[model samples]
Target chain A: MTTSDTSVLAPLADVDPADLARLHAGLEAAADRAGQLDIAYTTFDSPVGPLLLAATETGLLRVAYEIEGHDRVLETISARISPRILRAPKRLEGAMRELDEYFAGRRTTFDVPLDLGLSAGFRQLVQRQLAHIAYGHTQSYGQVAAAVGNPKAVRAVGTACARNPLPVVLPCHRVLKADGSLGGYAGGPATKAILLELESAA
Target chain B: MKTGKPPFEGVVAEHSATVLRVCRAVLGVDEADDAWSETFLAAMRAYPDLPADANLQAWLVTIAHRKAIDVTRARQRRALPVENVPEVATTVPAPGDQDDELWHALKALPDKQRHAVAYHHLGGLAYNEVAEILGGTTDAARRAAADGMKALRTSLMGSKGATR
Candidate 1:
């Protein structure tokens, strides 16, 4: 569209600033009173089977699979945060772009920033080790534990992978069991299997 | 009003189109989705403390606008080496015969003016409303929108004049 058409829309302008100010103030008041916000929703047809993504200003806090009772999950998030939640596919910009590139075989590594605040120290260490796992390569949990400077932390590394905050970005899927088993993924073993397969195919 | 309900659900349901329009105006269709999502997420986090009497639509618009700007800035930051970054092909479909070319022209405008026009015109917001959302005064909003509209008109007319 050209600028001329936009000029014609000038006649439609008439919103009140006071109304905007009032709205902003009201929302702030509600959030403050509520403590945290409950913002959880899912979009479909994602390469990874109806992906679930959630976040706050502090950073991404959760990503899950599409199970039943999604509303209950949303309520849980709201209870932890506030009830001022909304759902829109657009908010997953960085994640979506990286996922798209990964699926398209154009990207082997994700450069997106992550907020692993919710993760514990050991989990963070495991995540860091997982990040170093080369594309199209898999490492046993023992190997990851060794990489994290805790040779006996293999079991801890497995648990840490289960608790990883940023999954796809950190490549926790790359960590297999000591016997080369697929191990576990919070998103599901099948999802992990598919991701590894995709990397191998690429 | 009773508390405990989702604070901005009403406002979101009411003004979602406006928020989406602002996002579309700023980031174009491809990236508007993410900007819109971030805006709502930010709103959700900020909603409880929002003043009771504020204009919800404008508040959402302001947030959406900021999110759009952030998305663009982030994209610019992540721009790869020239060889790695593929050329952006123009995929915007052609306008229909009855379609107004003014919005198309407006999209060609600089980011600030484009935002000004979207907030004031497409959003059906007053100059003061635009200003508040943009962190400026009524006069500034008016000036930006006016300048944007003027540019759009001139450009459109020039194109038409050439065609004639």
Candidate 2:
């Protein structure tokens, strides 16, 4: 609907931008305090691109690349998890720090707690084994499938790695194709290459 | 569970400015911030149960309306006469201090007119939605907002014209 068409009322029509920002920050904090914030998220500028870090009170939930569409990912999280989400950067501080260290090459393993609610059954089992692949090491889809106790599920393993909700944190980039080619990645192929190079160089 | 609702953060990010302007118009700036925060906090709490197709801006304005009423009631209870009054000074406003004459004029409006203007004009809701919130017919809500704007123009512009 259009606002009232009166120039004398122009000043009343809009809120100061800075004041609106301050109000948003306050509301975010208030929501967090009241334990109503079901999911908290923030964006970080990473070497791969901007990463969307989101979490629930349970643990770190989803980390998305800009290519994945941050808005779409958030909608998915809202649908799959809960719609009570807020952009509160402070809640993701722990995961952010661990990722910061991982990208800096100073840390190999993620110590932050994770919420694997986005995946289930076979996919969850596949992601659980990804962290054991070692930092600079590579594992074939067949190998991961075998390791997860489904030796015949090689293609399934490939699908799991491709659909991994938490990519960098779960080390899906370490899983490669049987032909030694980077099969596919959620963050695109070039990003997978950058992550692989970052690990191998360290 | 529904599988297509957009994140509540999107709701907050998109409509917060409008909500703030609505609150400020209805309750004045000092009370507006608290009303805005309380409204969002309440909205977030009940968000999961909200229908996916719900009008988010109108929904938020509904919540803001309730919150503004609560704030107004609390302010009324806290209203007390001061023992000593400072001398009235006609000091010019400081650099960062907002010019509050317009806000004062808005607060002086009758409650129905103030609410109608805030909900329809600033909150961007249709007259029917404003009527729903204010408990009246759409035409009445429209008339109240129009009347409120007319009064504000007469007072604020008339004062400005007198000075010039």
Candidate 3:
């Protein structure tokens, strides 16, 4: 299906816990049927908060808020993807290493490969702009738009930042309003502020 | 002609972490980073030809998996096995040590089972979807995930004696 269709099919947030459990169980069963499906999972600290990382045969697959129910996040992801899920700590080594170095102020840029296949144009443009934001600096949405060669697309850029999938990796938190206001983020403005503050401190 | 390039950058932003996870799982961490980049670069090249109905996450994962496997094979052929593949360090949290144990148990499953479990339990994919990306049928995917869960339950129940 189109990426949009898949995005639309992503498990809705309001699914009942009981239903989520059932889905989770079904997933477990599916994994068994497929034989050994290797996955590596780990928990790491980020500027925002504790994060749970899940990796598979591809790359980093799930980065969930630690405070959020892992099952709920799984349900949301599964509703859009597949039934084979595993918890793998070993798989997260690359991300964890990069993240640790980042937090320690030893690394300024991330070399991890990113897959942004699910998003569309405006959002992609906005995320790209966010990436160019210097580690210790911030830019307004208007500036981001201008950077993307669409100075008139400030509102669109804001929407793009709002929908950014990679969040910290793409540095969407660096996008602010022309008035120097912190723009909205899917991860919350508070988290964005903390990220900005953390980068600034570094 | 393709009217416009698909919003690949947007897709990367949304799904990069997920794709990275898949690469790591398949190729381990050292090779995963490279494989992950290759997957995206390939995706960019193929974007114009991709079907609209394809699930972007699954599609990317599939590509990443292939890329990881390719890298591993190439490395093996070159006799350049990466030494000292990093292990996931266990940092005990003040609370919730049990969950950590459970996570460790989940990690012990074989690769295919792990992928199935991660996709279903963590990535939250349906059996059919998992099968599609993993190159198997729904039934096969279900069976792999079930086997993995069975192993996990057994390991967790016997944690007292199981190797940590």
lDDT of each: 0.68, 0.86, 0.62
Tens digits of lDDT, candidate 3, A1-202 = 2121111112211224453334334433343344433333457777668776655556665566654555555544433443233443555678889888877777777776655643667777677667788898888888888889999998988888776655667777888887888868766778878878878888
lDDT for A184 (candidate 3):
81
Tens-digit lDDT track of model 1 for B1-164: 23344334556667756776666666665676677667766877677777767677778888887888899888877765444643334444366522224445656787678888888776777788888777777888788887887786676676667321
Alpha-carbon runs more than 4 Å astray in model 2: A1-5, B80-98, B160-164
Instruction: Give lDDT: candidate 1, residue B45.
Output: 68
TM per prediction? 0.46, 0.91, 0.44
Model 3: CAPRI class:
incorrect
Give a tens-digit lDDT track for model 2, residues B24-96: 8888777888899999888989988887788999999999999999998886566545434331233333444
Q: Which ten residues in a row have the lowest lDDT in candidate 1 chain B?
A: B91-100
The superposed Cα distance between candidate 3 and the true structure at residue B102, in angstroms, equals 28
List model 2 lDDT by residue over A1-202, tens digit each: 4455566556766667898778878877888888888899999889899999999888889999999999999988888898888888998999889889989999999988899989999999999999899999999999999999999999899888988989899999999888899989999999999999999999
Q: Rank the candidates by DockQ, best first.
A: 2, 1, 3
Decreasing lDDT order of the candidates: 2, 1, 3
Model 2 chain A: ten consecutive residues of lowest lDDT: A1-10
**Comparing candidate 1 with candidate 3, which one achieves the higher DockQ?**
1
What is the C-alpha DockQ of each candidate? 0.13, 0.68, 0.02
- Could you say which candidate leads in DockQ? 2
